[model samples]
Target: MNFKELHNQKTPLLLGNVWDVPSAKTAEKLGFQAIGTSSSAIAALLGYQDGEQMGFSELIYFVKQIVTNTNLPLSVDLESGYSRDPIIIAEHIKELVALGVVGINIEDSIVKDERILLNGEKFASTLIDVINVLSKENIDVFINVRTDTFLLKHSDVIEETKKRIKLYENAGANGIFTPCIENESDIREIVNCTSLPINVMCMPNLPDFNTLSSLGVQRISMGNFLFDTMYSQLERITKDIIDQRSFQSIF
Candidate 1:
């Protein structure tokens, strides 16, 4: 089945979020149904902050490497498409498509000194322009429109998220991704509000896979948690090796 079709399954499609070739390869070896890049994780790997600090070309190179080294269907976290211009975003999408990517998560928020949500209506319009450009070229991509309402903890978040869901769906989005949505009630309400597959990121309080499927979450993402967890373990192992004056951690 195709990448998009994976979301239509009765249970949620768990995306193994990877940062590099090793991570992607690991996901594949573990029998993950699919994999996607973690923009924050990738940026951190390159000694940069998240939110498009890494250049689009750099992202392309890294994605190309992962695609070349793996057989699984891959999606990318475009992180606002690396440009405000919708046409440029479409061009970026085209480049990823050429590299064998099947889906993308493009968010509606941008980072200044801190994160902030873009005007939902305006962002939806941008999605329209971006999708239009891709359509003209006959390119098909799973445009998983990522909205930051829950992540930013906006007041009236659920209502605002449902509103953005409609706007994004109307703008030709194939799915809706709202990071930091951990509540079962919110997930069910959001899923009830739209036909688009709802994607939730890994949060401290996020429900288990069975609960998520029961709530009608069509997709689940690890975001950057796996990358963080792996490195955190490595740091601990190094400390243990230093204290013992032996490379015991290697075993």
Candidate 2:
């Protein structure tokens, strides 16, 4: 099935999030249905801070490498589109589409030293403009709109998410990604409110796969958790090697 169809399956699509070629290869090797780039992880690997601090050209180059190396349907986490201008964002997305990207996760948040939620109504307007531009250019790609209400710890995440998802749905979003939302009831509330596929990210408190599936989630993402865990293990092992003062661990 295509990337968009994957979101509609009875079993929620489990997306392996990768930052580089090896990670992408490993996900494909292990049989992940699809994979997505974690923009923050990619930025860190390139020695840049998260958000859109990494240049668009740099992102295109890195994403092209993954696209070239992997066969699995690939989605890119395009944080805030790297620009507020809808035209420029659409153009950036076009670059990804040309690189064979099947879908993308674009969030409604910006980074000014830290991530902050954007005005929902305005972001929806931005989405409309983006959709219009893409349609005019005949560019088709799954646009998963990420709302940061839960991510930012909004006072009322469930209600705020419902409000934003409706706006996004009307704006032609293909999916809704609510990161950092873990409570089963909250997940059910959001899922029940939106016709668009509801995507939930991996969090420490997140429910198990079956529970998420039962709650009506359509997509489950790892965000940067896998990359974070792998590297955290690497750091620990390297530290252990130093403490032991031997290369025994290498074998």
Candidate 3:
């Protein structure tokens, strides 16, 4: 199934975010209709922190590996498109599309000493340029515009999110992703405010698939949770082996 049809499923599309070829293969083997990359996960795997610390060449190579091995549609989490210039961002996206990427998540947050969101109007302008470039190049990539209002805990989050969603939709975003939004009322409000597919990240307080589906969510992404959990388990197993001086932990 195509990425668009995956969103239109009876149940919300669940993307098992993978950071490497092994993880991508595992998710695909487990019957995930599509696979997504977590920026933080990819960064950590490459011995860097999140926020585009991994070089673009390294990232593209990693993505090419997954695309080469997996049959599922892949959506990459390109944090802020790896550049401030919209034309450069579009070029980066074109490269990914050439590597068989079907979708991408581009956020509006700027990562500096402190995380700050870009101005809504300015972000929308950049998004329009990126969309225009993609259209000109004849690349039909799904642009998932992610807003950081809830992630950054902005005071007027609901209002600001709604406003940005409207702007981004007009800017040609195929979907809206609001990570860290757990409130039912807020989710409902955002869902009601836009016709675009809603993509929510998995968080501790976020509702389950059934609850989210009822809230009109179309896509549910695990983000970096799986990678974090896998490493956490690995840490536990290693500590167990060191303390007990036995191979029982492997069993």
Candidate 4:
């Protein structure tokens, strides 16, 4: 099934976000329907900070590797498309489409020295331009528009999120992602306000899969949680080896 059909399934589409070929293969082997890249995880692997610190070429090369190694439809977390100019962003996306990527997540936050979100209307306009370009090129990539209202804890988050979702949907967004939103009531409100499928990132405080599905969440992404957990395990194993002077942890 295509990524769009996966999102429209009765059960929520659970994405295991991966950083490399091995991780992508593992996710597929374990029966995930699709593979999504975690930009933070990829940035760490490339020895750079997230938020576009990793070069676009480096990111694309890494994505090419994953796509080459796996048959699952891949969606990339292209943080702000790596540029503000819509044309440049569309060029990056077009290259990804050529590389066999099926979808992407683009956020509205500006992640420079300080993390400031773009104005809702302006971001919507940017989405419109990018979508127009993709359409003109006959690319069928899913555009998941991410708004960081809850993640950034913006004031009047619910209302602001509703406004942004409305504008983004009108701009041709395929899905709406609002990460860090754990409250059931708020999720229900947002889901009710928009016809576009809702995607939520995994958080400790978030409800379980059944509850989220009932709340109208069509997609659930692990984001960097899997990568972060893997590294934490590595740290623990290294400390164990140092303390006991043994390689038993590896075994």
Candidate 1 weakest lDDT stretch, 10 residues: 181-190
**lDDT tens digits, residues 77-105, model 1?**
99998998998999999999999999999
Candidate 3: regions farther than 4 A off: none
Order of candidate numbers by TM-score, starting with the best: 1, 4, 3, 2
lDDT per residue (tens digit) for residues 115-172 in model 2: 8999999999999999999999899899999999998999987788899999999999
For model 4, give the 10-residue run with minimal summed lDDT.
110-119
TM-score of 4: 0.98
Model 4 ranges with Cα > 4 A deviation: none
**Candidate 3, which ten residues in sequence have the lowest lDDT sum?**
1-10
lDDT of each: 0.94, 0.92, 0.93, 0.94
Please identify model 1 stretches exceeding 4 Å from their true place.
none
Off by over 4 Å in 2: none
TM-score of each: 0.99, 0.98, 0.98, 0.98
Clashing pairs in 1: none
Clashing pairs in 4: none
Which structure is stronger by lDDT: 2 or 4? 4
**Model 3 lDDT per residue over 43-106, tens place:** 9988988888788888898999999999999999889989989999999999999999999999
Give model 4 RMSD, 1 decimal: 0.7
Query: What is the number of residue pairs that collide in model 2?
Result: 0
